[model samples]
Every structure is written in C-alpha cells, then in structure tokens.
Target: MSSTKRLLASIHDVSPRFEAQVDQLAGVLENHLGKGRFAMLVVPDHWGAAPLREAKAFQSRLRNWSDSGIEMFVHGWFHRDTGQHSGAANFKARHMTAGEGEFLGLEEATALRLMREGKALIEDIIGREVAGFIAPAWLYGKGSLAALGQAGFALAEDHWKVWKPGNDEVLAKGPVITWASRSAMRTASSLAFASLARTVLPHALDTVRIAVHPGDVSKPSLLSSIDATLGRFARSHRPARYAELS
Candidate 1:
C-alpha cells in the first residue's frame, strides 16, 4: 500500500426511517468522492422502529451498495440508550451523547447478543461481511468493549481511534471529525471544529475520518459545511475504505 494520507467518510444512522436523509448525504458524498467510496453505518432498527429486516427495498439497496464495493457496518441494534448508568458510564451517557450511545451501558452478555444479531442481520441483507462495528455516538463501556472482542468483529472505533478488537492493534489514531445537528449549540460547535479540522487535519494526521448523520440534512448550513469540508479534503487526501486500515 502507498504511504499517502487518506480520508475516510461515512453516513450514519442508516435505516428506513431516515432513508431520504441518508440518500441526501450519500449523494453529497458521491458528488465529492464518487459512488461506493464511503461507508454506511447502518442501524438495524432505529429507536426500536424501522427495522432493516422488514424493509425489503432497503435490503435490496444495501445489497446493491455492498456489491458496488461500499462497505456496510453494524452501527447498533436499536441506536438508543435505554439502560441506567453510574460513574463514568453515567457521565458519558448524560454528556457525550443525547441518549444515543447504545453500547455505553450494556452488560457483556447483552452487548454480545446485540453484536452477533446485528452483524448477522447486516451480513444477511448485504450478502457480505460487514466492515466492522461502531457504537452509536462512539461511546463504549467495559462490557461493550469486552463483548466486542468476544463477538469477533475485526474492527471497532471510538472517537479518538480505530483498533482491531481481537488484538487491540491501533490501526488509526486521530479524533473523528463529525457534525451534530440536534441543537443549535452543537451545530455551531461542530461546524467550527470541522472548519478548523479541514485546515489542520491534513497536515497533522495520515488518516482522517469524517462522519455525517441523517439529522444533518435538516440543516442546510450543516450540509453546505459538509460539502465544503469534504471537497477541501478530497483534494488533499485520497478517499479510503475503512477495511484498508485492517
């Protein structure tokens, strides 16, 4: 492999519920990086609704994308944080995300079950192995980490880094550049961070990851920011698949 720095892009919260939004983000990414160049983090069921198993058309679409070389990743089963927490988990559950860290408070058995089921479901739909597993909001607890290793996922990522679950080998090191659209404050902050990153990250790291959520489609400013950020990096960084890091 060449030693060139790379850019990794992905669309998050992919499900029937956000089909339109995912399409919009995908289109934007394709415009900059071409089709099948980015990954999609699919939620098997979004907030206990819009299960992928029941969406036949979406399943076909996933398979088509998979066949086209787009990577699929098991994002989370429900993509909702419903469990109680305490201490560090409690702090992360309350502050790191707004009730979206599905793996942050799970027990080992429950996490393992969800991981297996989610991986199986995505693989069946796509007719291929998923690229990896990533917890919603990039938050993980002890049990989630333990279960990730047992679940046999080759790759897993948090906010700061991507690593192999089995041997804990660090494949990439850098904070993921992502945007949030839930609130005005978050939107502004993320935009500012992305602007800074667009200028600084290329010179600072060999691998840069950018993730966009379906909610970002609701904000025209955020979408525009995403386009500009992606276009800027696409010039300096080669578009890369997550699997390449492995």
Candidate 2:
C-alpha cells in the first residue's frame, strides 16, 4: 500500500524429488540477487514420503544455504491433502491447487503434533532454527491457526500476508505471486496473471512476494516469465527478507 516496493524470492517444495528443479530455479534467483537474497520453503516430508532427516546430503545443503543468509522456512508436514473438501474448500482444492492442502482441515491436536514434529526435524537437520512455517497451498484450518501457536513457530504465512504464529501479529500485507506447472492450462493462466502483475503490482503495493516452486522450472515459458517478472520488480525495488518485514 505504501509503494515502497520490497521484493522476496522464495524457492518452495525443497525435497529430494524436486532438488534438481529447486536448483534450477534457485540459479535464476542467485543470478538476479546474488547468493543469499532469497528464501527456501522446505517440506519436511513431501507427500507423506521422503523425510528430510533421512537425507544427510540435503540437510547439509540446507545448512549451507542458511549459513549463506538464505532464510529457511518449514513448508508443511507432508504437503499432501488427505481429506474431502466441500463448498469453498472444494472450489479451492479443485482450482487453486492439485489437492496439496495438507493442513486445511486438521484437528488442533493433529496439527500441533505435525507442526512440532516438523519444526524439530528441520531444526535437527539444519542445526539452526527455521525462520518460519508456511502451510502447503497456503491453506490452514481454523484449528491449525491455534495449533501454530501451540507449536511455537515464530512466523507463518497465508496467501495474503505474513504474520506471527502465536499472536497472529500481521507483519506484511500483500498477495504472493507464484507460478504453477501442474498442467499446461495452469501454467498458461499463471503466466498471464504474472504478465499482468508485472505492469500493475508495483504501482499498487509496497511489498512483492515472488514464490517460485520447483515444478515451475520445468516449463520454459513459465521460467522465462518468472525471470522477466523478477527483472521488472528489481528495477524499482530492493530485495528483502520476510523476517525483516516488521
């Protein structure tokens, strides 16, 4: 709202399955802002598989990334949706994501357990505390909000803003711009949205959150749009970290 124009580049879905793609997208960010200007949203276990603690080399890589000033975030427990949806949830699950909303309807106790376990696992692997947690698909159940406080995460992000977990302290307000490569139609729509955002976003708001998922790297045009979008924002705004938002 202030038109100050702060930029944040985040690499989402950092698991072994997407490591190559993560590296690919990361390289583009590294090229733009140099090492350490971006962030990583790492899933502790993606799709109820591939736990982070089992991958020593990946843990080491995350350590190196953290040490270099790239902020690390606990993405989700198991970035997979295992529940039925209805009404708005159904609409969201059907259109916004490919059913990856893992925390969308979890009970408070279950959500707390997952969040605590995930935070601990990531901390043990990285040997450093994480900066925050972001639920998969940026969707959280009402109970998950309370559970975040119980789990003691310093920060959490939804689609529209970043906030303190326990207290719900709003840190920054802005919609994150991201691309999806789950299908050709999604990729094309995302690019068109991004193209419009390129010309309109900076003038309308102060903060711009560019969240890049690994799958997006698989599409040439999506990747190109990401690069161009970043370039356009960098021309007017300086790179920033979410932790520094407040």
Candidate 3:
C-alpha cells in the first residue's frame, strides 16, 4: 500500500456511564500504537431519574486527553430514545430503529433545549467548549441544521463529510462505518473497502473515515477490521488530531 490516504476514527458514548468501555477503548487505542492520535466523541450525562455523577470523572479524564491533544466531538444531547428521526427507517436500520431518530418522535423544541443544556453541561464538566454535534444515529432530522447552529458547535460529521457548522464545504468526504444490519452477523467495513476501492478505481478518493462504537468493537471480526484500518492509517498520514482540524 502506498500510504495514499489518512483516517479519522471517533468513538461515541453516553456519559456518566459506559466509562469502563469508553476507557477501555482509550486503552485499546493507546495500546494499538500511533492510533492514540484519533478522537473520541463525548456524549452528555443526559436526563434520567437522577443526574449521573460521572461528569466529574469525565472532566478529569477529558483534561488528560485534551492536554494530550486528543480530539473531542459532542456525541449528542442525550443518547436516549428520541422516538423520531428526520427520515424514516427500514425495520433493519443499523443505528436507528423506527423507535429512534429525529423523525421518529423527537420534538424540535425539546431537542434544542437538550442540545443547549447538553452543550453547557459537557463544557462545564470538561471545562472546555465542545466543538461539534453528532446526533444520535447521525440522524439529525431535517430540523436539526438550525438547532446545531444554535448549539454553539463548530463542526458536524456523518456518513458523508466533515463539515463546519452552517457551511457546505466538506472538510472530508467518505462513508463513516461498516456493520451488519441484522443481528448475529460478523463485521464489515464499507468505508475501508470503499477507501480501498477508491485507491484504484476511477473515482479514486484520497481520504478515509472510520467511526467506532463500543458494541462494534467487542466482536472479534470487527475489532480486527478496526485494527487493520488503523494499521493502514498509521503509514498514510499522521493520524489527525480532532481539535486541530476543526
């Protein structure tokens, strides 16, 4: 491989919880060598019966990552069941079920309120302003573009490209992830394969995007695929630092 492309991998989680797996992911990247140069999408301590106390832990840990120059993108206001989405989902949607999304049922007002509060809370906990918003399932309903501008974030990413808020210029363009839609199937990389295909095909592209979820990693095949993806990236370009790009 001639090291023609680079990668940006982001991990998502609901805060004040899942700290273990989240940290384990950090460890995985650290142990994976140069992979530490990637990023982590920090989700908020979303509404629940009581506030999650993990924000404090998130704060301390975030500082270390920040100081080390790790990238941080806001995952969502609440990684909860919004019961709606901008568009519809087939019963087999991977990240969104009909039960989730901006069109599924999320009220525009409530979603914005959560976005405002979540942004405030994450910045308060981390002691730094978050840079972007990634809706749960990457399904920021048709109403979300305006909400994002109001949320005070600077970047937005999905299956398409990395974009600045309120702009059409895609900082990067490519598929973000790969997985089976139904249960019990092994892992795959639509992005990696596409990236590879582009390495030779007529519409050759020079960038690759990688998105990771804790669940996708626990599986052996997916984990290995992720490793291979990182391995390719190691020689391609200095793994990008999130904050630097945004």
Q: Per-residue lDDT for 161 in model 2?
A: 92
Backbone clash numbers for all candidates listed: 0, 0, 12
lDDT of 2 by residue, 12-38 (tens): 889976888888988999888778999
lDDT per residue, candidate 1, 77-187, as tens digits?
999999999898899998889999999989999999999999999998887899999999999989999999999888998999999999999999999988888889999
Cα deviation at 80, candidate 3, in Å, is 2.2
Worst 10 residues of 2 by lDDT: 1-10
Candidate closer to the true structure by TM-score (higher is better), 1 or 3: 1
Question: What's the lDDT for all of these models?
Answer: 0.92, 0.85, 0.59
Candidate 2's displacement at residue 95, Å, is 2.1
Highest TM-score model number: 1
Per-residue alpha-carbon lDDT of model 3 for 1-246, expressed as tens digits?
A: 344445566777645566666776666666554544767776665434224345565677776775675666676655656452233543323344323343224556766677777777667665677767777666655456666666667788766777877664567776665443235533344435634643443234456566666665556665666666566555554455545554
Which is the winner by lDDT between candidate 1 and candidate 3?
1
TM-score of 2: 0.95
TM-score of each: 0.98, 0.95, 0.78
The TM-score that candidate 1 achieves is 0.98
List the lowest-lDDT window of 10 residues for candidate 1. 1-10
